[model samples]
Target: MIIHGNRFTLRPDADAAQIEEALESLRNQGRVIPSVKSFVVGRDFGGEYEWGATFMIEDLQGYWEYLVHPAHRNTDQVGLPLVDKFASFDITDDPDPEMGAKIAALHQRRYDSDATLTQLVSDLGEYKGSAAPGAHGER
Candidate 1:
């Protein structure tokens, strides 16, 4: 299983409605995305980021499904612009030593296929993770 996590801080100008909408969209991802085995989206109590979410998937293929799903892309469109900082991580029990590279490749492929996604990520104040732009040899 792989546990994918994201944490983000909203821009100070973000209004309540936008925040709620983003949160609701995040919640909807777990419900609408079939590849998500389990998930949680909520406020970060003591973390540096304002909100966080975690998604559990059975394997790399499931993770790819989760990433490419329409619902997930919609969430990114709705939520990415409102956030000033964002970071993501993955913890997996898969035994393959190449799993990390494979995961990063999936993300890179997603970005390569969508110019809007690449721009959305570029607009962020900060983004960090193994699959982040420029990370793991990504341009």
Candidate 2:
């Protein structure tokens, strides 16, 4: 298994809507990429970086596929401009006989049975569009 992690700070003028749009794009990318087993993104409070993302790929080939994917390329074009600074790393875990089963169980627990990446993107877009001022507290 390959784990890719990233931490980044968005530009001063970037707002939650822009952030969500980037996240939605990522989710959409994952949907089309078969190598992407699972992915997650989060916001860090009172931290040096504002956001982070983690991606789990099935193997090295999958990792390569993900890198060359058009959706992934779009992220570089559309998402990078909003970032102030960023750092990323990849970890290749040692092969374990039970890793596949563990990954399957973990994915099942983390994602809803009916949930699809498209739905997740849509939900994020909805939040971006309707979110009210101060709804998330100052900043």
Candidate 3:
């Protein structure tokens, strides 16, 4: 299985209503996305981030589906602007040595294909790891 996790800190100007809506959207994503085998989203106690989420997928295809799913994009639209800092990490048990690069490529392609997504990410205070724009000096 592939496990993808995202950690973020909301902007100071983010209101309570938007935060609740974004949290609900995060919860809805796991329920609506067929490719998500399991997921969780909640407060982060020990981490630097204020909130975090993890999504479990069966394989690369499922990961791709999770990435491109409308719910995921919707979550981005609602959540990205509220975010001050964002980062993602992926863990997989697959045997392929190139799996990490493949995952990053998928993210890169997603950002490349979606101008809105690229802009949302670019507007953030900071974004790190995986397919993050300029994470590898690309985009």
Candidate 4:
């Protein structure tokens, strides 16, 4: 699975409910939206994390498609008039489970720590799993 960070800024008139509805519709799509094995969009309920809402794309390509796809463009058509509400927009991608882990492990090893790096790596190494790494209280 590939993960893409897609942060959209809605027009000032758009409300949370409308944004929520748009995301819900996308999640139910049968096709025409590939690479998006799973997607989530919504307003923040509580706890930590930035912004009022966020979108998660399972496939970077799928997300790229949606980013330009008419399907999204059409729905967002209604929301576009309200776009000014947002302060910024952002999107990022990380490859599926296995590779992302190795990449993070490397980063954590290199930039995360030196004195603690060995111990941290060892602790993570203790886990025996084939799947990609999990979120570690990340943003």
- Candidate 4 is scored at a TM of 0.38
For each candidate, the alpha-carbon lDDT, in order, equals: 0.89, 0.59, 0.90, 0.40
**Residue lDDT tens for model 2, 58-137:** 77567667766778767755676677666555566756665434433333332333244323323321111111112221
TM-score for candidate 1, please give it: 0.95
Q: 15-133, model 4: which lDDT tens digit per residue?
A: 87976666555444324565455555554345332223334555434544545555554444443343332221224455344654443343333324343323332333122221112
Determine which window of 10 residues in candidate 2 has minimal summed lDDT.
130-139
Top candidate by lDDT: 3
Per-residue C-alpha lDDT of model 3 across residues 17-81, encoded as one tens digit per residue = 99999999999989999999899999988979999999999998998999999999999999999
Which ten residues in a row are the worst by lDDT in model 3? 130-139
Clashing pairs in 3: none
Model 3 ranges with Cα > 4 A deviation: 134-139
lDDT of 4 at 125: 16
For each of the candidates, give the backbone clash count: 0, 0, 0, 7
lDDT of 4: 0.40
Q: Write down the lDDT that model 1 would get.
A: 0.89
Stretches of candidate 2 exceeding 4 Å from the true structure: 45-47, 95-139
